[model samples]
Target: MNLNLRHAIIQNVASNTKEELEDTIIDAIRSQEEKMLPGLGVLFEVIWQNANEDEKEEMLSNLKDGLQKQ
Candidate 1:
């Protein structure tokens, strides 16, 4: 069986509205469950893929700050 988690995750949320997507992200973060990590990673992958250079730089900067705080 070939199970592509990233593809599955993306397909699952493909029809989500902006607010639904926001809720999904927020809920996943607040859940703190290991299983949710893959879904979050998939979402981040989509965001990173579509982000412009400036957005990517901002994301990296935010990521750096987040790591520092942790």
Candidate 2:
């Protein structure tokens, strides 16, 4: 079977409002389910692609801090 997971995920949430998107992200993180990782990754990819250099740096710093907490 052929599947475009990223495209599918993007399409699934394309119409969501900001609040709905926030809820989805929070739910996915709280669930901590393996199946949700790809969705989160796709979301992050979207964010990364759209972010400015300063925003990207902030994200990288946040990620670094998060990893250090582990």
Candidate 3:
């Protein structure tokens, strides 16, 4: 992460009201994920290493169920 971006996040989140704080945390988590995904083959490799066969299938099933509700 860039130093300026870190500083910006700290400043904004620190100043957040109760309602804004949830959004601030969600945005920070999303930003970190955006920086890691697709190109980060190591992330998939880790997922594969840790997730068992049944766990993967269950995750896929839950994803499909959630999407259908939407």
List the candidates' TM-scores in order: 0.92, 0.93, 0.35
Clashes (backbone N, CA, C under 3 Å), per candidate, total 0, 0, 0
Error of 1 at 34 (Å): 0.1
Candidate that would win on TM-score: 2
Q: Where does candidate 2 clash, by residue pair?
A: none
Kindly provide the TM-score of model 1 when superposed on the true structure, using C-alpha atoms: 0.92
- Any runs in candidate 1 off by more than 4 Å, and if so which? 1-3
**Over 4 Å off in model 2, which ranges?**
1-3
Query: CA lDDT of each candidate?
Result: 0.93, 0.93, 0.60
Q: Which ten residues in a row have the lowest lDDT in candidate 3?
A: 36-45
Residue-level lDDT of model 1, residues 1-70, one tens digit each, is 1249878999999999999999999999999998999899889989999999999999999999999999
Taking the tens digit of each residue's C-alpha lDDT, what string does model 3 give over 1-70?
4557555545545665867865644565578876534323333344567899998898789879999999
lDDT of 2 by residue, 1-70 (tens): 1259888999999999999999999999999999999998998989999999999999999999999999
TM-score of the candidate numbered 3? 0.35
**TM-score ranking from best to worst?**
2, 1, 3
